[model samples]
Target: MKTTTIRTDLPREEKRKGAFMILTFFGIMATAGFLAMSIDLGVVAVFKVRMQNVADAAALAAAQEISIALDEISDQISSGNVQGEVQDANSYAQDQARVMAEHVAELNGMFIDPQIDVLFGQRTLDENSGEATITWGVSPFNAVKVIVRKDNPSQTAPDAKVDLFFAKMFDNDQVALRAEAVAYIDSRDLVVVMDFSGSMVYDSLWRSDSIDKLGQQAIDDGLYNIWTDLDSPTYGNMQFDNDWITIPSDSSSSPKVSLTWKKSTVDITTTKQLDYARLYFSDNKYQNFSSLSGQSKTLSGTGSNSGKLIKYAKVRYKENGREYYADFDLFDYDTLKRGLDLNGVNYPYPSGSWNSFISYCLNDSEVNRAGYRYQFGMMNLVHYWLDAQMPYSSTPELWKTRHYPFNAVKSGGSLLCEFLDGLDFGDHLGLVTYDTYHRVESQLVPDGWVSESVDIGATPITDDYSAIDTIQKHKQAAHYYNTTNVGGGLHEAIKLLDEHSRYGSQKTILLMTDGNANTSDNNWSVPSDFSWNAMTDYNGDGVADYTTSDSHKLYTFVRVKQAIDKGYTIHTMSVGANADRDFMKAIAFAGDGIWVDVPGGTTVAAMEEQMLQAFARIAANVPPPKLTHSESP
Candidate 1:
């Protein structure tokens, strides 16, 4: 009591200092409280940002999964494997979407179960506001919507709570967050135009049997059998079938062979037996011998001994105890052997046997005639080589037989089928082949679209598999033909896409060829007057004037331009050496698409691989599903 009595009499300065301390203590407490509130808000803000990021990822993942699920269901329905119900399909897609969302959310630090929602539908433009609104229960089921939530109290399984540090002083333990995203799959209509021209059948390894035999002989003999002296003036007389007529030495004109007499060294009394006989001939025809009396006389010999009888006239001579014969045709022996002597055709003495000589001339002539003229037709060495490589029945018509290298079209078609198998469900595909004419093998239909024509009991196409099956059947039935009609194929492709493609879908043409446009007329479906250039009104009078005819390339260019104007993109692929790269590139450029060149290879397998790679590349380049919207609602 005594110590507290004098406290009120302190100086004014001291009292003021004490009051300031009390106010400062209250102010410090207030500042701490405010700091704690800010900490809490900062923690909540960070958590919201993190949760929003997670929601975006989850939504995108869920949307993609839903799209895939819907595609599977559509494929099943189109394949006839299942009669798809919109409700069941949507339910399945939603389940997939939820699973994907939860999985993605968990990957992004969401430990507790996150709230997820999915919708399968279409996005349509609002006519009034020009805004897009997602509408559910639409045919084709091309759209998906996903919503992800964190710590949402309304959700049965809310997202994991975001713990607070400094905010704990304020009793704020966690925060709630949510995000939504919408995704849609765009429809694509694609047409594939293939070229099946005559050149498509060309194979470098293709040879005839005759050529092979001659080539083998040349290899064995170490000499090229081709006649190099064919231009020689005496070459015609060397022919085995040439008629040789020689006149006796006494005949006027000129003697082809002159006679000379020599005294016999051993028998001087009998004199050399007409040592050598000489004969003369006019031109290549036989000249009658005129005796010393100026009377015409013919000398002939008969014998079945194997010898090439060049001329009808023959001369006989006696030596020792044997009689020998010589034909007037033998007079040309010196000239014939002049060039052939180096090879093996040897004419020994004038009385030598002609057996070997005859055989050599006949074989040489056969090889020369057949090899130089390519007279082996389909059975030439090329054919023989092809046969050895690819065995088949030795049918009369070899070209008609299907073989490895010749099956390029089939291989290409098979690759196309493989590509088709990978197409997204709901994408429409059309097939067309061009030669002298263009044929629509298959009309544009959804990737899941199927027909009883392909498989009677097959389930409607519900997915890409059935669509691929349909395409496979068409490919199998396709056959190669003669001319390349690019314009006709393009025309048919456009018609098919226009007739069967759904509105608002992407239209594309996959044009493949091994050659340039070779046909001028569009004889597929259009009339003659409306064929190619005839259909274009160049003067702008709206009337097709046939004044100037258009080339195949120009006509095809026009068609490509028209298709491009109609919102069609053309992707062109060239195969083999004959393919026109520039032309195809031009078409692709005009159509606003890509151009692929599938180079030829040394081997059939290599070629097939190149083709497969080309097709795969094209498939990969196909327009992918674009996300029109990727934001939370």
Candidate 2:
């Protein structure tokens, strides 16, 4: 504006300031562009992670559904509810798997229906190579692979993609992503080492609070129960001493001598006996007479109505005269038909005082051939629980052949099959029972025997398992007697797994007992000079090394360690109060397994409940579904 008094220094300063302003503007523009690019990249990265999470979650859900559906199909095959094979089951499982995957994907912020691919197959381990191989579209489909993606369209929705928040300016707003997973229902091998000791079948109340009144007592050191009129010495309704009776043939006279008795108090040397005259016709009618009184004359049809004969009477005898004159039963039932069995024993029962207590076992219904399960719980009476279609009747000394606890064990084993079926995986099961002798009933059997005929070693049939356990259990339970050799049982179980277990599968020993370890390999009858507390080697060679309780317990641990050393878990179960608790817990601890003790209550219901729960826990002991692999689709 006004004067032209310009200096050379002022012009130079103005030029420098202009250069500084231009450099600052360029640096600010470059920084803003870089910040925008970084923000767009961050948005894409975050959404990519979220899409991968959704895919993984969806794949897991699909695999889980497939596993559950396969389980249902197996159940249907077992119960004969549906006549379908594993391939048929796979069809349904895959379909539902797709649905489950979509549902899960949606739940995890995937608003669109994502592309899901589900495939059913079997995952097997190569025995020689020790590697797992997945084969698709197999018969026993136990493995499922799921692939979830956002790039493909579904029937109800368009393609799904991870949207970028800050990349819109660059016209790159979305990214396609996918995930995959393979879940295998892994296989397991279990050997049920059960206790079949004689004590397993004791009377339900044998261990009760008020056992004196109704419970059965074990005799011969818990080997058997005679149940010899245990209520009292003065029991009621004994069989008539039929040696005195001379039954006539059917074609006897009109006033036929069908049955007869005479009065002679000789060997039956009770003081005041029979009255020989107090006869009962039935519950409604009875009258006293002296025809069968004095010398020898209680003849047929004496002191009785025509059609209704003497059903019961009291004769005081069969005693060593140590107690009072207690009168017991005399009867005219069909059991008194006076015949010998093929074994030369009395046909219906034994002779005289042994049959003296038979009437106490007989109820009003059994006396009439009606049914026998209600009265006194038919204690040692008849085995028919209310129906004639039930198994064989209860006979003296036949509690081993027919009872509830052993039957409960068999049924409980069947329940294990049910649980195994629920696993939807192929499994092998074996059996070993220990009493005085430990016998292997069956070798490893597959849970899904796909063949028409059941054959072990690789085939499986829940029915296959069912049939084997059925036949073997009955055969072995018939001999549930003598001592408990837990060591021997574990030894057998370990051998079974060692020989039959499949490679890349779990080998497990489920050792069950209702008693302590008593019988070592040797059945000791004579006491050898050995310490009762030490783990003794009687012969000093290490075979049959256990001679006492402590030694037997240690020997059991030694057997358990064989499986442990081979990478197997030993799960211990105790089914009764008398079971060896400390040893069971210790062995389980040593093998890094679980110890479960189910209280053996005093009834069949309780036994059933205990075994069911115990096996259920054992079933749960399997490792959770094997997440075999996860990867990009």
Model-by-model lDDT, in order? 0.49, 0.51
The whole-model C-alpha lDDT of candidate 1 against the native structure comes to 0.49
Candidates in order, TM-scores: namely: 0.45, 0.54
Off by over 4 Å in 2: 1-146, 152-175, 204-404, 421-423, 443-463, 476-481, 522-549, 630-633
- Residues 239-338 of candidate 2 have per-residue lDDT tens digits of 2211233333232222222223332111122222222444455454655444232222342233335444355443322123321222223342333333
Q: How many clashing pairs in candidate 1?
A: 31
RMSD of 1: 19.5
Give the TM-score comparing model 1 with the true structure, all chains together.
0.45
* Candidate 1, 325-431: lDDT as tens digits: 43433334443233233225332222223343433333434334334221111122222223222111222122233332335555555544444443333455566
